[model samples]
Each structure stands twice: as structure tokens, then as C-alpha cells.
Target: MQKPSIPKGTRDFGPAQVARRQHIFNVIRRTFESFGYAPLETPTLENLSVLTGKYGDEGDQLLFKVLNSGDFAKDVTAADLETGSKALLPKVAEKGLRYDLTVPFARYVAMNRGTLTFPFKRYQMQPVWRADRPQRGRYREFYQCDADVVGTDSLLCEAEIVLMMAQVLNGLGLDDFTIKINHRAILDDIHQAVGGVVGQEGSLYVAIDKLDKIGRDGVTQELLARGFSKSAIDRLFELLSVKGTYLEKIHALSEHIRLSIGTDYTGYTDLREVYDILQASGFKQFDRLEFDPTLARGLSYYTGCIFEVKINNVQMGSVSGGGRYDNLTGSFGLPGVSGVGFSFGVDRLYDCLEALDLFTSTAETPTRCLLTHFDAASGRAALPLLAELRAAGIPSELYPDASKLQKQFKYADAKGIPLVIIMGPEEAAAGVVKIKIMQTGVERVLPVGEVVAALTVE
Candidate 1:
């Protein structure tokens, strides 16, 4: 048999990695909760129809089609196959893995319209699949940390989302980040300023999304190659280079940037705005932010303000991106509702933390105290001690098999357990435990309280 292997664009996170990931998710979840957003989840698979046209043509092509269940090949024929994979799909395929959480959420809201209250706010943490060639930091299967508020067209929601982005980064101990802001209308403004090019309109947003990858020059060349006149490309650049604070826009496009999303007026000024809003309400600490005009997130669906977060020195793609989708619910038959939100790319953020050495020691290895199995009788005697450690709210585990002290210590050290509790014949008899500092190789005899206090001191 061929050697076993997993698919590309996927990963198997070990225990250590899972712990680190959990820490990151907890940070985002906590921040979202503080902002009054509730938690939600959408399924992994959605009807092929629900996903097809929502993400534009390029995104639609990246969808992973799920074949019809059991006896899938019963209807296949050679002639049908000869026409090509696309031609043969109807006989077997009916559903597809979700490309993103947003569309599925739209469907969810529509399905539960009457049962749910208006202006619903929910945050969803779930894995989404995209069938594209993966690269460093980008994966085919990854989790999306999304927070969306629907049922109102409030600029306050947009401003709050901006603040929420800053809060999560600041919470992650990431003080250095930029929240690039853009609006789809601003993109439309640029396109219109380019003298109303015909085919250029459709691909305008897609080309803009490549701003980070190709830079201005490359993007100009791409637009030209795609039938845009050099004049149109130059016009596009003119609009892109108009850099002023989002609050000081020179026109309607600029004014929209300044207007607080989900509100009638702009909130506060710059990155401190989030802090100002939260601090006034008893929350402090915030992250840095920048207003990058070319941040074209959710190109086709996002209707209003958009955002992207990036760690300053790290050389990876965005750690998060999202925007306002005004008519998303309408696509599912609920008209006139607007929502603004953002998503954290958890895996990319994890990789970024690793690269920057920001992931703490605890994040990497969470299990701290390991109770060694000294002997069968000693192991039985040590059970209560383990219970006490756990009762004190410590992540303590017992070595199931009674192994040699050295071997058990080695196992605990490998797993980065900071302290190893040794309860051998002598210690058990004496009602004492030998706490060994696995990192420092310092051993000391202590009572249960003392052991708890020692482990508690980080």
C-alpha cells in the first residue's frame, strides 16, 4: 500500500498546538463577548446553491464539491465523463463544503427569521474549507473567528467592529498592528472616476484585493492586461493615493470613511477611538490602527466599510479581514437589513505569533504539573494528591502506568510540565510529596498546600 498521507492545505494540530490555539480563540471570544456579541455556529456543508454566486466567480470556483452519498458512481457514463469534470457533475454532486462562514450565516438568519429577534448579533467560531492551492500561512481547511451584527444599518456597528479588531489584537499582546479600512463605495467611486470602463467594473474589486501582493505597479499592469486602458489604470491610482485620515475625506467616498459605521457621525479619532468608547464604559487597553485605502475585503459581498489587521514586522498575509454586508440577508429573502463584522484568521495568527515569538510559554505547553506514578501502591496513594491539585484549579495529570522515576520525569519534561510530583514509598508514608522543578532540576519536600503554592507562582 502507498504510504499514508494527509491532503495538502490541511494540518493536524498536536496537543501543544491545540492549547496555543485555544488561548488565541479565548482572547478573541472574550473580547467579542464584552462587546455584546453572542456566539453562533454554521454547518460545514451547505447547499451548492447557497454558496455559488455569493463570493464572486473566482471564489465560486474554489468551492469543494461534495459528491452524492453512497453508490455515487451509479449514474456515471463514459460519454458524460468525456465532456469533462464540469459536465459530469450533475449525476453525482449535490452539496459543497462551506467556503466561508458568512454565507452560511446568511442562510441561518433567513431560516430562523421569525424565531430570532431583529438586530441580532452573533459571533461564530467554525472551520471553513476552500479548495485552493495552499501556501505559507494560507490553508485549505482553517477556522474563521467571525462576529456579525445584523438587522440594522448602523455605522456604530462598523466603528465598534473597528474597536473590536483593536481589542483582540491588544489582548493577544500584539500592540503593533494596523487596521486597514476601505469601503466598497469608495472602490466604486474610483471605478467611476476611471471614466466608467465597461468590463473593468466586474474585475475592479478583484484587482484591488491584490494590492498587498502585486503593489501599485503590478496591479496597473494587470488592469491593462485585462483590457483596462492605461488612462483608466492611472485614474485608479489617483484615487488610491489620496491619503488623508478617514475623517477628512474630500468627497462622499471620503465622508463615508469618516462616518461611524452603524451611526450618524464618526466615533472617535483613530486607534484610540476603540479605547475611548470602551474605557468610558469601563474597558481599557487597545491596539494600534492604520487606514489603508486599498484594503478590499469581501470584494463582492461587503457593502460598506472594510477592515484588515496586520502585525507590523511579520511577513505574512493579513491575520483578519471583514466588512459590512448590507443586503446579505436580503439574498436569503430578508430585505433591508445590514450587518458589519470582522473575522480572525486563527491559524495565520498562530503562525504569526510563532514567528514573532509572541506565543507565551504557557501557550505552547499548557500542562504544568504532572503526578508521577512511583509504584502500584504509591500510585493508588497519590490519587488523592492529584485530586487536591485539580481542586486547586491546576491542570494536573497522573502517569497511568507506573514507570521508573527517571522515565516518568523524562515524559513530564518532554511535555513541558513545569513541576513533577514524586510520591514514592518514603514520601507516601511520611505524608509528604517531593516537588521537582522540571526546568531547574530543583527538588524539595512539601505538604499539599506548599506544592500548590509553589506551582501557583508562575
Candidate 2:
């Protein structure tokens, strides 16, 4: 028989792995909830129309489309198939695994616009699927923990997002990551100043977004290949190379844009206002907050601020990122509703935590104590105690068979159960039980009624 196996870019998490992941999720969920965002959930399958066009062209290509259910290609003409997969895709696939949470959330808002409250704040923790090749810290399937606020254009939402990002990272014992911030308007002004073609802005962003992966020389070559003039590329680097503090960089970029394009620097003012808000709120993590002029989040719908996070000293891609979308809802016929949010790449974060040795010891199994018995009578006598232990809110389990003592002890040790109750024939006859501390091998003989309290204290 062929060996059973899971697909590449997917995983089956064991108990320990699940426990560790749950720890990360609990921290993020608590942080999101503390910020007054309620939980929300969306279906795994969304209409292809809803998933596509929100992300950029490259992102659309990464969508995992679901083939239509029966006779999917029955209506297809040979000419349609001959035209290629691109032209024939719509005829066969109508739904796709969601690429991200933001778009579906926008769709939900558009559909329920009449009943939903404005500025709907929600947090969603769910899995998303992409069709990209998988590598270390990059998976075809992963979880994105996202929190978004819609129906407002206020910069306060941006500031709060930064704060929440910091809180979530720090709460997860990640103190050395940088939160990079940029604005789409800033990128647009830079594009215009660099004499970029109007309709080819996506090409510029796609190139610039790879600055970290490919250095300046590589970006210049790419720009040239993409029809950007050398002088434009030179001007682009000059603007991006502005140095000094966040305020200093903002001022310098603002002045350069105002001089080059002869227009007001609204993006600069927005950045300055966000900075002032953080400063007023006594945000002390400025060192961790960076004003990255070259940070262009490649998502198409982002119209205002964009954010990305990277942990220092880790050889991995971004662990979290998101941005402000001014009119994502417009595509769904709910025009002018604005929203901002960020997503934590749970898989990458897990890899980071493992690399940093940040995960504390968590119980692999919820079973706190296992009841071991030598004979059928003792096993029968332990039933009431098992019920009592459970009634006392302690997780307890009983070995099903009249297993050997060593076998039962090994089972408890392997499962990381801290306590094991030995209700042997003698112990049961004496109306007492011996609780073994699995770690230290110390055993205590206690009355049947006191077992719960003893285990509870331990």
C-alpha cells in the first residue's frame, strides 16, 4: 500500500505543537479584545470575485481557486480552452480559498451595511490559503490574526494599531522587532516625482517592495527593466535615502516632494500627526518604530498608512503586516467606507518563538493526573474519585485496562502528567490513595477525601 502522507506546504500539528500555538493565539486574542475589538469569523471559501482584485496582480495569481463542483468544464467551448487558462478560469472556478481576511471583511461590511454599526471593530483569527511555493517560514496554509476598524478616516485608528502591534509582540516575549510604517500617498508622490508612468504604479511598488530582498543595485536594474528612467530611479533612491529621526525624515521627504511636485505634502502631515499622537500618549517604543520611506506594501487597496514587522536577527520574512484601505468596500458597492488593520502571521511567529527559545513550558495534554489501578476492583473503586476530581475542576483520567504499574507510570511520564494516583488493592482497602509526583518521584499517602485538595495545591 502507498504510505499515507500530507501535502507539501501543509502540516499536521501534534498536541505539543497545538498547545504552543494556542499560547500564541491566546496572547493575541487577549490583546485584541483588550482594545475593545469583538471576535468575528468568515467562511473559508469565498467567491473568486471577492478574493481577486483586492490584492495586487501578483497576489491575485496566488489565490487557490476551487474548481466548480460537477461537470465543471461541460459548458466550456474548445475555443475557450484554446485561449488559455487565464481566459478559461472563470468558466471552471467560481470560488477560492480566501487569500486574506481583509477583503472578505470588506464584503461582509458591504452586504450588511444597513444593519451593521459604523466603525465596526472586529478581530478575526482564521486560516488563509495561498498558492505560492512553500519554504521555511512560508506556508501555503497559515493563520492570520487580524483586527480592523472601519467606517472612519481617523488617524487615531492608525496609532492604536501601532500600539496593539507593540503590545502583541511584547506580550509574546518578542521585544526586538521593528514595526515599519509607510504611506501609499508618500509612495505615490515619490513615483510622480520620479517621473513614473501613471498606470504603471503597481510595477513600481512591486519592485520597491523587494528592497529588503534585493539591494539598491538590484532594484535599479528591475526599475530599468520595468521602463523606469535612470534619472527617475536615481531620484527615487535619493528620496528614500533621507536620514535621521522619524520627524527629520518626514520633514526632509515633505520638503523634497513639495519642491519636486509643487503640491502640498498631505502624507507628510499625516505621518507627523500620527507621530504627535504617539508622543502625546507617551509611547516610548519609538526606537522600535521606523519610518521606512521605501516600505511599499504591495497590496493594491491600501490608500493610506501601511505597516510591516520584522524580528531582528531572525532569517525570516515579515511575521506581520497590514495597512489602511480607504475604499475597499467601494468594490462591493459600498463606496467611501474606510478601514485600517494589521495581520500577524501565526506560523512565522511560531517559527520565531521557537528560534528565540521564547516558548514557556505548556502542558502537552490537558489531563493533569492519571489514575492507575492494579485490579478490576480497585479500578472500579476509583470511579467516584475520578468524578470527584473532575467535579473539583481538575483534569483527571483513568487507565482503561488493568495495566502493569510500570506501564501506567510510563504512560503518565510520556504525557507529562504531573501527578499519578495509585489506587492499588491495598490502598483502596485502607481507604487512602498514594499520589506520586511524577517529576520528583515523591509519593504521598492521603485519605480519599483529601486527594483533590492535595492535587489542587500541587
Task: Put down candidate 2 lDDT per residue, 1-458, tens digits, no spaces.
Answer: 99999878999999999999999999999999999999999999999989888888899999999999999998899999789988899999999999999999999999999988888999999999998899999899999999999999999989988999999899999999999999998999999999988897999999999999899999999999989999999999999999988888888888899899866677878888889898897888999998999999888999999999999968999999999998899999999899999999999999999999999876679899899988888889999999999999999999999989999999999988989999988898899999899999999899999988877886
Tens digits of per-residue lDDT for model 1 on 1-458? 89988999999988878988999999999999998989988778888988888998899889999989999889899988899877687788889999988888889999999898878989999999999889998899999999998888756677788778877887887777777776666566566666656566667778888988988888887787788888878766766676555444333344443342222222223223433454565533333544555667644888777788888889998999898888888988988878878899999889988988987775235666888866788888888878877888898889999888889988887788888888888887787888888789999898755777666665
Mark the 10 consecutive residues where model 2 has the least summed lDDT: 262-271
RMSD of 2: 1.3
lDDT of 2: 0.92
In model 2, pairs of residues that clash are none
Model 2 misplacement above 4 A? none
C-alpha lDDT (0 to 100) for residue 150 of candidate 2: 96
Error in Å for residue 235 of model 1: 1.4
Could you tell me every candidate's TM-score relative to the true structure? 0.87, 0.97
- What is the C-alpha local distance difference test score of each model? 0.78, 0.92
Which candidate has the top score in TM-score?
A: 2
User: Which parts of model 1 have CA positions greater than 4 angstroms off?
Assistant: 73-87, 248-287, 363-366, 447-458
